[model samples]
Target: NPLMQPNAIEKISYGIDEAVKATGLGRTFLYERMASGELKSIKVGGRRLIRVADLMDFLQNAANQRIS
Candidate 1:
């Protein structure tokens, strides 16, 4: 069931390390973002995880920003 659940949108989860790498952020910076709620995460049995979709959306938003 655990394996099958990841295939579903509602059952998504990501490890902190993976999220950090995906966002290209350092450890402290990643934690700061998490603390500020700029990056959304979920707690699972004493660990934190990010949603892949959320990260994708964040990246898309960043890409859409226009340079001033």
Candidate 2:
């Protein structure tokens, strides 16, 4: 798909907006997760960013929890 192939450069980190879009999660929910330490995020120059690997790990752990 050309649409999917347009951005070959993978992102190492994502701001709140991008993270919400990528994860299909609500903005408030993401903040809640971050606040609860369920999801890890970092603040850089007043902007909050989540690492791609951390996001992936969060999702994987959530999935595993559901299975158990």
Candidate 3:
């Protein structure tokens, strides 16, 4: 049903605030990961764009980790 959903291209860009809301991550935590090069982002004009694919990649990677 994903194809039935709106396309990402139609959404334009995903900013930090949107990412934060989508991931429920704190601003500082997200920014820290970005600063540490753990997360990748794209900059378009004055806004940062994190693709839905990239975010899914990040989540999958994070989920793969074993927290003991």
Candidate 4:
């Protein structure tokens, strides 16, 4: 009990660096996608954040395209 770790909190959004780490995609590529409107992101103050749902949707759509 004392040594047990707490459950990790799921992230609702990720900054550019966090997204890169989560997806293993390069920063340039991610920025390109954002610029092209393939991937959606929001500007919060000075930070750009990508919603987890949007990221998942982007990956799922890509997979579907590959399958088709």
Using lDDT as the measure, the top candidate is 2
- Model 1 lDDT per residue over 1-68, tens place: 55777775553657888777666877787678779877777888898888888777766766777542
lDDT of 1: 0.73
lDDT of each: 0.73, 0.95, 0.78, 0.94
- TM-score attained by model 3: 0.73
What lDDT does candidate 3 reach at residue 38? 78
Better of 1 and 2 by lDDT: 2
What residue pairs clash in candidate 3, if any at all?
A: none
Worst 10 residues of 2 by lDDT: 1-10
Give the TM-scores of the predictions, in the order they appear.
Answer: 0.64, 0.87, 0.73, 0.87
How do the residues 1-68 of candidate 4 rate in per-residue lDDT, one tens digit apiece?
Answer: 32464676768999999999999999999999999999999999999999999999999999999999
Q: Which regions in candidate 1 have their CA more than 4 angstroms from the true location? A: 1-11, 66-68
Ten residues in a row with the worst lDDT in model 3? 5-14
In model 4, where is the ten-residue run with the lowest total lDDT?
A: 1-10
| Candidate 2 lDDT tens digits, 1-68 | 54779967768999999999999999999999999999999999999999999999999999999999
> What does each candidate score in C-alpha RMSD?
5.1, 2.2, 3.3, 3.5
Candidates 2 and 4, the one with greater lDDT: 2
